[model samples]
Target chain A: MNDLVENVVKGDIRAVARLIRDIDDGIPGVREALKALYPHTGKAYVLGITGSPGVGKSTLVDQMVSHLRRKEKTVGVLAVDPTSPFSGGAILGDRVRMQRHSLDEGVFIRSMATRGHFGGLTQSTRSAIDVLDAMGKDYIIVETVGVGQDEVDVVKSAHTTVIVVIPGMGDDIQAIKAGILEVGDIFVINKADREGSDKTLSDLRLMIDMDQKKYEDGGWKPPIVKAQAVFDKGVEEVLEEVEKHRAYLLETQGEIDFRRSPKRVREELMDLVKNRVIEEVLGKLTETGDFDAAVEAIARGEKDPYSACDELVLPRLEIH
Target chain B: MTGKRRIRIMVAKPGLDGHDRGARIIARAYRDAGYEVVYTGLHQTPEEIVEAAIQEDVDMIGLSSLAGAHNYLFPRTVELLKEKGADDIVVCGGGIIPDEDIPTLKAAGIREIFTPGTPLDVIVKWVADNVEPRGEY
Candidate 1:
């Protein structure tokens, strides 16, 4: 186990892959592995790609990875796919699109299933990113299984977020704007060879313009790039904009970090603390018989949930 | 003891076998049994299967080959995995295999062969009873 963590930190692909599986499986001692890995993380720049299915997001990732690799950058990709609610199976076909890079040693790609995990990325995903980051990957790309406003939690895991959309999807524009507009660091009009590609680009530009507060806030303006990812066209341009976004973040590190990182850290800390506290409280409550009695009382309509929550939580609250 | 580790299995169809009814069924069975299943859609090569197994760090490689290339592709996959230092990944196969060919395949490191009519539960139980993730469990 110690050797596994050591090899993972040394960027051993096999060991890195094994640790990710261990973390995914919730195997014992993986927490220690991640703990050992934690100090070596935060070195890789996390890039998130999100778009509705059929927008060619996977192909875009493939092309972007190639472009990054050409610059001698080592990349790690996490392709998120939805787990079957009934069977827990996932096709994980993202690798099919990116098979051209399968033989490349510098690229490490893993497919993840959402598996009903709430929030942006699954808990496994965060740990997987840590593994990749600790492996010293220069760039980590997370391609969301499905992109929408609801999937904005992905932004929590990414330093720069790329929102992809294709031509001829007029009806999806409004909903996309509402859900992901604020999160996009770069907007890509993939399938630029299509008929409505120009119109789609203009529509995104118009939306960005309309949101003046996003500009007044003085953050970097998101750039819209045209791409035909299948042909590998315009991928480099999109990546250039991504690099610019990264440079902008570094140039204005304090402001961007203050605006984004602290809230993200707080949310992550709260998620951890909340789960641990709930587990402790629930175990104690179950042991003390109050949980079952409360359940029975609630079922019998004798006690309201508001009062019950107080009865359960008041004594546990610590005044700091 | 297995503990509560969720076993991950990759069900792959290699060498142009488009008939995926059996592969999909087994993938679903593993999923329903609470194991994480990574299904490589049809027409994968031996190299692709080995690469997927290594990258995914799967506990087992469930190759479903109906194109009669299992005699060649299945062992080649195991060999490639061994060459890549991932020989510990358990390799199993299911498809149109004649009774006479099973011994040679097993000797070549194909761990188990599930011919037609092999019950899904049987395969699931076999995997549960046989496979564990590499390293100290």
Candidate 2:
């Protein structure tokens, strides 16, 4: 397995990218690669910044990167957007706003699109993060776009989750209460310069207070911070709170453990295993000419998808 | 299919950018082009995306980010993918990419940049030509 990518670290851009390509394609020799780099998986503190559209998550990330650079910590930011099917491209308009941190040696930024995979849930992403960790990035920030309540699901793997909010978005607190509130490690009310900032903060406080009863974890609670991301206001405070949360996790291992329960592990494991099995079975099914027949049957309503999936599909994927 | 290992691809979307039209199209293109495409639904964390790559045993991850969230999502994907020892996967990017960020994207370990107006043949050819699926032996 002496491929060009073995024993490669992440200091350079092309090397890391090539490695990602190889891994993303599910080439055979990747187990050896991860086995070689297993020790570096948990070093980087992962920060997930998410909010409704127009909350200025990017501007906030810019400010955070600036602050991180001041402390001399290497930062890697991952921004995800959508691509055009016709053109196979992205505007990446967000990156255009954060050019200030692009040239900094310690800061690296990249924009990714789902590029027509079922969703942007690519395994290459996991490997990419490891590469950055192995490269010694102290902070890794992933800014995700909100897709209603389900958007919060991605943050489950994050070490720290910052839910960004705008001031005048009418019921910003309500949205938080609806979905993002419970997921927040720390809540950030961005665009604090706007009017109604107090109402938003107060409403958020009230919401947090309501959840106070459900939260039981050595008294761990998500804090709220206000910031005008355009001006980089309170960005440092936000970062500090993120650090505080990370430090809190380190100091209070009991909390992180409880949050990352067995159920969480099982769900992630199932997802991983399910996808892999489906790939193998799907390839076989297609190769054996059952795929199109199954599809046509489903399309023609000759059979139920569940039965088809369980019998023709699941049987093959069964480890037994 | 020849002696080459099938190209494994994890097609993922990182944020609330739920516009899956492009991501879906490319996933099909990759599939039709004879690559194994893994599609994780919208609003995936970078870590989740990376986890999918590792568990699925993929060789390349194609991410489609449309809501201007790529900067935060792509590098995070890169960082996690590398950490997990699947760094040999070529990370190719496609979306409404601005010309200015091309160098930055490349610098962030993007193997190849797929911009708007890129033909499907080009994308199909690029993956077929570049990515080699692991362990065909």
For candidate 1, the TM-score is 0.87
Candidate 1 C-alpha error for residue A227, in Å? 2.1
lDDT by residue (tens digit), candidate 2, B1-137: 01134445778778778788888888777766655465766777777667545544567888888888777788888887778666876788889778888788779988787877899889879886788765331
lDDT by residue (tens digit), candidate 2, A1-320:
33333433546544544455455445566656766765655668778788887888888988898888888888977765545556553333455455555346676665544344423343445456666666668888877755464457567657888988878776656656767777888888888888988988888788788766656646568888988888878988998888788778768664443225576567556655665665666668878988788889999989999888777865685566
TM-score of chain B of 1: 0.94
The candidate 1 chain A region of ten consecutive residues with least summed lDDT is: A115-124
TM-score of each: 0.87, 0.65
**Which residue ranges in model 1 land beyond 4 Å of their true spot?**
A87-89, A117-122, A148-150, A254-264, A282-320, B1-3, B16-22, B117-122
TM-score of chain A considered alone, across all candidate predictions: 0.85, 0.84
Inter-residue clash pairs, candidate 1: none
Taking the tens digit of each residue's C-alpha lDDT, what string does model 1 give over A1-320?
78988888888878988887777665678778888888888888889899889999999999899989999999999998877777655666687787667678899989877766334244668789889988989999999887654468666778899999999998877777777877888999988889999889889999888877867888678899998999989999998898899888888774443225777788667766764566466657777998789889989999999999899878876654
Model 2's lDDT to the true fold? 0.69
Question: All candidates' lDDT scores?
Answer: 0.82, 0.69
Q: Which stretches of candidate 2 lie above 4 Å from their native place?
A: A1-10, A24-28, A83-91, A115-123, A148-150, A171-178, A214-217, A254-268, B1-137
How is the predicted docking of candidate 1 categorized under the CAPRI scheme?
A: acceptable
